[model samples]
Target: MRVVNIHERVYRAEPDALGALLGTLASRGDRLWPVGAWPKMAFDRPLQVGATGGHGPIGYRVEAYRPGRSVWFAFLRPAGFAGGHGLEIEALGEGRTLLRHRLEMTISGVARLSWPLAFRPLHDALVEDALTRAEIELDLPPTVRRWSPRVRVLRWIVSGGSARPQALAG
Candidate 1:
């Protein structure tokens, strides 16, 4: 099955400012990625083309990079994820910027089931949390999104039943 997932937000800030956040991805000073709740995005080397790392069980390598504009990761794991995902910064009119995250892939084998049943819900929630973090970092009021009950349960299951439901409500 082919899957295309995208999430974006327009912030009332300059493109340069949002692009700076993209530049800091996977670094200690990362202003994006909701690392604490979800797994931290780590790479063997610094952010650049060829760096390899991923959060949690998902894995990928930096397939392309443009310091302040965009980054794309070609999926490297989960057995059947074929294709890639990326984050981009788009400048709008004066003092406005759009941050977009997109995932395009084809899944086979178990992933055909997993993608729809479990991973998609969790992925959606995680991306929203990442966007909320970006808004908070930009000093903008967050557009908070409550997690779906299914997502809460999945997080708990993924955590081996140790994660509190309330805590998983990202």
Candidate 2:
């Protein structure tokens, strides 16, 4: 088991505002098809996340959900291959929300060991790049203040504390 990729970003907006933006992006199931899911109706179902693209026949389980605050999802790959992805929204100030996305991927079996070492870095880089692109595409404002490396590390330490499944209100 090994980490393949990890990417995160901080948006300079309140959690509600950020959620609104994410809601817009996730509004159309077709729009999210590239990531996963088949039709628009799929996203309508409560907490149902299934694979639709090249990621294989994987599905996501909502691990945690805090309305207008944070959300966590676990990707369940076939044959015991599992990974977790989560978004943490922390209120930094009056009008700023620190959005942190964390990803943990573990590859098992003899055939998968090589993949983690060979593709981990690439996946990490790709995730970071994708987040940057998403920020640009979403037209989010620049972060008012960026957290220090130490602070970020500390935050990561406590990230696991918040993990509970809940229905998302559309």
The candidate that achieves the highest lDDT relative to the unseen native structure? 1
lDDT of 1 at 102: 100
Worst window of 10 by summed lDDT in candidate 2: 32-41
Summed over model 2, clashes come to 1
In TM-score terms, which candidate is top?
Answer: 1
TM-score to true structure, per model: 0.95, 0.53
lDDT (C-alpha) at residue 165 in model 1: 42
Per-residue lDDT of candidate 2, residues 101-159 (tens digit): 67776667742853454334333433443344335444654222233344334333434
Could you give me the TM-score of model 1 versus the true structure? 0.95
> What's the distance in Å from true for residue 62, model 1?
0.3
What's the distance in Å from true for residue 48, model 1? 0.4
For residues 83-136, what per-residue lDDT tens digits would candidate 1 score against the true structure? Answer: 999999999988999999999999999999999999899999889888888888
